[model samples]
Target: MFTGIVEATGEVTALDLRGGDVRLRIRANSLDLSKIQLGDSIATNGVCLTVASLLEDGYESDVSSETLSVTSVSSWHIGTKVNLERALTIDTRLGGHLVLGHVDGIGEVVHLNPDARSWCLRICAPNELAKYIAQKGSITVDGTSLTVNKVEGAEFELNIVPHTLEHTGIGSYQAGSLVNLEVDVIARYVERLLLGDSAANT
Candidate 1:
């Protein structure tokens, strides 16, 4: 699990495509990788990728075909910079909501405009995932936790302060940008409990 709090921004140094799968290497920027070991999980752009190898400046991970198909990783280029977050430990602070590093659905940025002191982004979520999103709810976008300012059908608006833009990969987003999205983990569990027997009966 992750907290959706991005520790640093890493640059994608290389990408090796093996049929449908991929091997990705990233330069870990200012992030501390001294304590990280191989087989440990790291959230990169909201996808949980295991650290396959340690590099001088960063690490490498293998992306499965299913992960490539479900998220925006397939479109990432060599120079693409990604938000990075380590998995939560028992002593880790929950600064942000609990995130599984599982990309539920990919969303598209429909509008990005400058507001008074911040920027306003309107993203269109997948129809199936839209129902789970609520106004004032938390949603992880490109590995950054953001509150939903407003929700209209399958689209939602977010107010991004200058600090957030500078800290995460969200600053580089454009209107046509594709992003990895993970809805609140609590909401999913609640829905399952409410459905209960009905879900099993089906």
Candidate 2:
């Protein structure tokens, strides 16, 4: 599990295609790598990837065919900047909401405009995932947790502060950019529980 707090920004150094899967190599810019080990989980752009191999300054993981089909990873290219966050430990502070590093769906940037010092970003989410989002609720976009400023049907708005713009890849977003999105974990559980015994079939 993760807290959706980006520790650093990493760059995709290489992408090796192997049969149906692709091996992803990322170079950490500021994320500490000393504590990481083989099999450790790292949230990369909202996708939980196992550290298949450790590198001198980064790591490599295999992106399964299924993952590529469901995420923006298929569009990732060399030099792509990704949000990086190590898996949270018990002592870690929960500055953001609980995130599973599971991309529930992909969203598209519909609009981006400056709001004084901050930037207002509007994204159009998949219709199926719309019910999971709410105004003022937490949403993880490319692994960075952000609050929803407003919700209109399948589209939601967010206020991105200058700090976020400088630290994460969100600042580079433009219209039509695809992003990995993970809704709040708690909301998914609550919805399942509300389904009562009927949830078992699902």
Candidate 3:
């Protein structure tokens, strides 16, 4: 599990699609290597990936073909910046929400407005996912936890502060760019329960 709090921004160094999985390599900083070991879980762009190998300044992981077919991690190109966060520990605080690091779907940036101090980003998501995203609710974009400023039809808005723009990759996003999106897990459970009841009649 993860809190969705981004610890560092890592750039893609290698991306090789193996037989049934993709080998991903990224270089990072601000995360201690000594504290990490093989088989450790790391959140990369909102996806929980186990560390297959460790290095002095980077690590590598393999994403199964199933994950690649359903998630946006497979669409990333080399040199792309990705949000990185270590798995939540028992002693760690829930700075954000309880994120499973499981991406539900992919969204696209529809608009980006740079303001005096912050930025207003609007992203378009699927109807099924948009229903769970409410105003003031928490959403994880490429592993960086953010609050929904406004919930509009299929497109929601975000107020990105300067700190976030500098710390994560939200600042480099352009119109029509694809991003990994994860909705709140609690909302998903609620939807599932309600849907199950509605389906009982048929």
Q: Highest TM-score: which candidate?
A: 2
Full-model lDDT for every candidate: 0.94, 0.96, 0.87
Q: What tens digits encode model 2's per-residue C-alpha lDDT throughout 150-180?
A: 9999999999999999999999999999999
The candidate with the higher TM-score, 1 or 3, is: 1
Tens digit of per-residue lDDT, candidate 1, span 77-177:
98999999999999999998999999999999998899998999999999999988999999999889999999999999999999888899888899899
Q: Residue 20's C-alpha lDDT in candidate 1?
A: 73
- As for candidate 3, its clashing pairs are none
Candidate 2's TM-score: 0.98
Alpha carbon deviation, residue 12, candidate 1 (Å): 0.9
- In angstroms, how far off is 167's CA in candidate 3? 0.8
After TM-score superposition, the amount by which residue 33's alpha carbon in candidate 2 deviates from its true location, in angstroms, is 0.4
Q: What is the TM-score of each predicted model, taking all chains together?
A: 0.97, 0.98, 0.93
After aligning candidate 2 to the native by TM-score, how far in Å is the CA of 76 from where it should be? Answer: 0.4
